[model samples]
Target: MSVSEQFVGGDGVISTPIATGVGTGEKAEVIGHRTADAKPSGEYASILADTPLQADEAGVASRGMYSPLTSLCNEPRFATMRRGHKVMVGQNGWLERPGSIAKKPEQPKKAGFFDSLKRIAKEVADATEMKSSRRVKGGERGRASSRVRISLDPREQSLLYCELEFLLTSALDCYINSQFNAGRLDADKYKKVVDAWHQKGRPKVVGFRYDLETQLDLVFLHMKDFRFYGDRASVPAAISGILEAMRVNARALRVRTFCQPDSVMAKQLLDSQSLLNLLGSAEQRQIQLAEVVQFFKIVLEREHKLQRTEEVRGLPQ
Candidate 1:
């Protein structure tokens, strides 16, 4: 049975891969579609091919919702390959025109390829329960049978990135909420920051579709002006607040990563099993919290140094 059929509890159901919207200069061709009714309960399935798939009335109307093969690309927002550069889908529209601004030259377009494969492998693992696939003998055993590789299309990759962005935003909100609940952050500050985030901060990040380090920079920028209490003693409280925030966030992220459906962030977290599993034990949680604090400290100090250097350069050089 194909992995997808396993998802919907279907077996021995031969699914023909269908193509849709072929040779349409404005649209993308897609592959891998099982029959509409072939998919069992509470799941959506569609296939895209070089040519459009002829589906029943209900399927025909819904086909455009998921696939880039026809209507998805009809919206200018869907990421498309242009001059070999992949575009990013924006929350409301296209983040960038493919060649408008060159992205970091060194960064690769298909960076999430392996991550998608790993996510599918993890999905298979969870579906079959890897423990059952294991053969514990003498000293060594065979690898688990619950492993598979998947090559994601550019459209799929864009969707995964969008989902991951949403998850990160959710995690950040949880962290902020934890601090607010602990009384470490002022109510006014919390409201203002969150409002600004939803109104401006998040939209900006989503627009850029930043990398991890750039995202961290954005976080620091947002938090730099944050004020809880204007007192020297409050400095320590501020740090502690953020430390607690990160601790809570890390644990929440761990739970979310394991329980949520397969995605890019989940795959990244699973790859770093130590970090993902840290919250399972008290000692590990403590260790992870300390590392998070140290990392925050390093970033803060680096930013301070850069500011100082810039000031000095502005004055003399």
Candidate 2:
């Protein structure tokens, strides 16, 4: 027969029964009642050593009769030792069991070499197209600027036309005189004819000081008309025709006899021809007629040194 002892377990509500007087190598049967459950239950029993039991500061007895394996399972470290469980150090050195940390999002894929090359090519093409467009616009602006129009009043135009007609007639008369009277080129007669030609349709003045400005005005007035009418090309053609006519007349009169190198008449004729050639060349080169006239005035002042008493004999006259 065996004697049964009843005592409260570590938890205050559960009562455990321990049987004594069991034979050696035989296990004692212990029955336990769990207050958490609705029924009294018993598990497979193991023989435990008779260890002394003590109470902690909380007035609860220490579990001395429990198996070492059971005590280890109840430890804080091994409590969360199952699969996929995590343990971390919480605030104040406490152990914490939290859920899994979220994974970082994957990085985006890199661009390929061919894609980079294509992007560079497109950028270059765009830059070139922009440059070409700008160049075309600049060219158009240059063309527009080049076609500048000049304006003139009717009175000025008439004066310019009359001057040109006078110059043409004087050139023809000089050429005719050179042809007809090759042996006797009368300088006085030539001067008289030119003075008479200029006096036509104007008030007769006994003596007037015709300065450089007056001479340039009288000679270059026709240039203004040509520029105003946008007929600059005709200037060269007119000069060429006059030069051709003079050459023909010179040929008929025998060049050596008509243009004596040492004579004042020959020098005047040559100077007139040179002045016309210079004007034609200047026109072809797009030089401003005002600048040409200024230069011509300077040359005339330096060479002729015309005084207040002398009349201004214009280039062709």
Q: In candidate 1, what are the lDDT values of residues 31-76, reduced to their tens digit?
A: 3333433332222222111232221222224433232223333343
Q: What is the lDDT of residue 222 in candidate 1?
A: 35
- Report model 2's TM-score to 2 decimal places: 0.18
Instruction: Show model 1 residue runs off by greater than 4 Å.
Output: 1-121, 125-150, 185-266, 269-317
Error of 2 at 29 (Å): 99
Q: For each candidate, what is the lDDT?
A: 0.33, 0.30
Choose the strongest candidate by TM-score.
1
> lDDT value for candidate 2?
0.30
Candidate 2 per-residue C-alpha lDDT over 161-278 given as tens digits, one digit per residue, 9 for 90 to 100 = 2332233333333322222122122223323433543566433211111222232232332332222112333566654444454444334333223222112222223333343343
RMSD of candidate 1 to the truth, in angstroms, is: 28.1
TM-score of each: 0.22, 0.18
- Clash pairs, candidate 1, are 19-49, 19-51, 20-49, 20-51, 20-52, 30-48, 30-49, 31-48, 33-47
Instruction: Tell me how far the alpha carbon of residue 107 in candidate 2 is from the true structure, in angstroms, after superposition.
Output: 90
How many clashes in each structure?
A: 9, 0
Can you list the residue pairs that collide in candidate 2? none
